[model samples]
Target: MSYINPVLPGTNPDPSVCRVGSTFYLATSSFEYFPGVPLYRSDDLVSWEQIGHCFNRESQLDLSDTDTSGGIYAPTLRYHDGTFYLVTTDVGGQGNVLLTAADPAGEWSEPTQLDVPGFDPDLFFDGDTAYLSYAHGPTLAETTIKQATVNPDTGDVGEPSELWRGIEGTFAEAPHLYRVDGTYYLLTAEGGTHLNHMVVAARSDDPTGPFEACPTNPILSHRGHPMQSIKATGHGDLVDAPDGTWWLVFLGIRQQGGHPGWHQLGRETFLAPVEWVDGWPVVNGGELITPRMTVDSLPGDGSAPDRAAPARATLATFDDETLDVAFEHRRNPDESAYSLTEPPGSLTLRGRTESLGDSGATFVGRRQAHFDCRIDTRFTFDPAEGAEAGLALVADERHHYEIGVTRIDGTTVAIVRLRIGDATETVVETPVDGPEHSVRVDATAEEYRLSYLQGDKDYPEAVGTASSKYLSTEVTGNFTGVYIGPYATTGEDATSPASFDYFTYEPTADE
Candidate 1:
């Protein structure tokens, strides 16, 4: 009956949950990655599976020019009357979009943009009336939670009224509205998304409330426990178990190293039991969250895939036409820039004018879920004058490490490039006699090492090593985790296609 924390790991942040019958569905933010909003299904709350994505097609969402961490933010998933509704903000693109699907695992309907002003949008259904609650801020220092009545079908919204301005935290966001025992409750995350994050609530008899703050505000937070592994606890969603038990799924980060936390895997989903005390919700019995716990009332057979394991290992041959759910591109990828069938069994990526630092670049990758893992890829590229293609360990546009193949002096060579903040340096450059050669990136807890395969041997030649600390959230000051994947870029009109024969990622046992 024991379950580990991070029910969903590695950048799966801003989790929202809803129940349909005995089944539960959870959705998380995808940021700038295309096929956005990863959805999961769990029969017993302990075992979860990726069912589908909410924004799987361009018609459903267009993140073409959105910046990293700017696409989809804080999606609120709710099931109502045989229809599943997803409401969220696009941050830099479309403001707020409402989408619906009959089945949570199937195709969602076209989005209906809402006229709401801010982010972290939530929807609550009561009879024929639907209510929308979202965050509104004049400045980050001063923010307010607001709500309004809305037509579910037409996206028409009534006038919004202030619900709560937050008790003490600066940024009050991620609002979820729930009615328990005929009393409307408003829960929100505050203290921003950093180490001081917390979940607080207010309740009233009316949906649009003159709400009273929970006397014991910040029902859940790790700010007081600096030594605790789980930090930044907030942005919670409540759900009722089949047996009438209540559970809360919230976002939290595991900080490694010393205090004044540093986290790299980004915000992840964590589960906690909830109890109703005097008509108010208390999370994890109003205590600091533990990394592992036993849920006696809920069944835990441990059949679910281990979230700590690398998403994929051995090989990703790109033989199938569809990209795996684990693979994601930066922003909306240019369809013409990538192909699976052109060369058959290999992923062909055409170089573009955009660099890895720019939006809409030709890059696709998976999360670096494990701190100690080996990621390698074999590719053949005949670059045009100024084109490059290779493997990248990306923290952000400005902070990443790349070992790529590019043409230099009429010869193709494997080069290791480092981009930390405003500095960019080429640390290694070795001539590749053939077009097909395997490049490997190995990451330990301390550093990331780059190498190349020689004569059928794995990583026979060493390139160099870079400190992993540079790719952490503490150094980048970004809200995303690192992604290890392939990238291709060109200058101006130059176009070069790089075909990846295969890619592999295996986590070390000790890590």
Candidate 2:
């Protein structure tokens, strides 16, 4: 069977996985997005469908004051007995939280605050004894993998002790422990999370151990291959399939052009094969990970090409009463600002005083999973003097590209705005005839083109273009990818609301 890399694309970083019988469950960090951790289910390990979010309610997650990429960190998903447990760190709010559910796709229990120190929390069960592993310390130089016995139900934790410090690398974190054949193995990611990132392993007779480093350390890395398409290969978790094969699901970013070029889609979740040699694990037969792979066997039939039941082409008319699981808001949104039945068939956004530059804005976006994709939407907005509503491609609060219509001097105008670093500028502005207009943004490996359709025009005219590198993590110094969707803001003096007719996201063939 053959499948593509990045089984989970877009901003799906810090992937953690576990299996139950023939089914596999995975979860990833959501950062500042409202729904904290995104959960997925896969039968073949190649195709995955987003089942639900662990933190779907406002009470469960609060990102109201979080900076870009400052809310939820790495999450570990594991199944113990008949219940599924998800443990993660809320970077800026609650320290650490553990949540459980009987059904992986159903509603989860409320957060059980754990007294664990550090982020990237993982839970390992060995015959009713629950052990927790996490990265601890204030600075990267002092960072180490710490393990502790914890009561998963009562949120009580024992004192944590240092495990392995990795094989002489900085930021030794993202630890996952496993017991195979009476041997305890601790795998970790080191060398930060950029081009220098790598995966290392250690083994011992016990979980908390004076462990010995693997003979072949730094088992998986693309650091030395500076120009490789895949870089920063680390933060991995291992799952034993029912077919008696071991698989590794990790996080990696795809580089576009030059050495350490740029990746705007964020760190994606990738899959590779694992094999045991002697007493340690070897990844991909000692080969570097690439964009595609062909394996001997997968869990189920190799017929899962359309991963999440909605791939390539996505259209939402807001006909349903609630938003789809794919749509996410920035932080804890004012739920009253968004509605689907206000006008019966359209999605309406009641403009807030907060702009895209602030948290809690009236905005909803989907991840830009593919490098070459287009997002199109049509909306009607009669701005109250300074009000504006339209589409945007956002990286964070201070970095994004927007195309919308706003009233200027009693005339409706279509405008394209670009925000990079600390500078904000209006690149294009044209007078329009009515309140309704169509806008779209086309993304390529190198740049993003924002366009708008004029009256009686068959095709959208290009309004402006921006280099994709400006939105990358290297440039923005953040841990999030870009999101494309609709937004509305009143800008303090206006009170008009915006109504969107429909939205579409389609991936195009890369050039």
Q: lDDT values of the candidates?
A: 0.84, 0.86
Clashing pairs in 2: none
**247 in model 1: Cα distance from truth in Å?**
1.4
Candidate 2 runs further than 4 Å off: 302-312, 458-462, 492-494
Best by lDDT: 2
Candidate number of the best TM-score: 2
Off by over 4 Å in 1: 299-315, 457-461, 492-494
Worst 10 residues of 2 by lDDT: 304-313
How many clashing pairs in candidate 2? 0
Model 1 residue 359 lDDT? 72
lDDT of 1 by residue, 369-471 (tens): 6667899998887786678999998888998899888888788777889999999999888777767767889887678898866466444344878988788
- Report the C-alpha lDDT of model 2 over 1-511, residue by residue, as the tens digit: 5667888888999999999988999999999997768889988887788888999998888788888889899999999889999999999789789999999899998899998778888899998799999998889666888989999989899988988777884698889999999999999999889888888989999888989999888889988898788899999999988878899999999978686598999999999999999989999998999777777767776555433323535689888887767788888878778889878788998878888888777899988899899899988778877788999889988899899888888887888999998999998888877777889898899999988875676433438899999998888999999988899988663378788999999888732
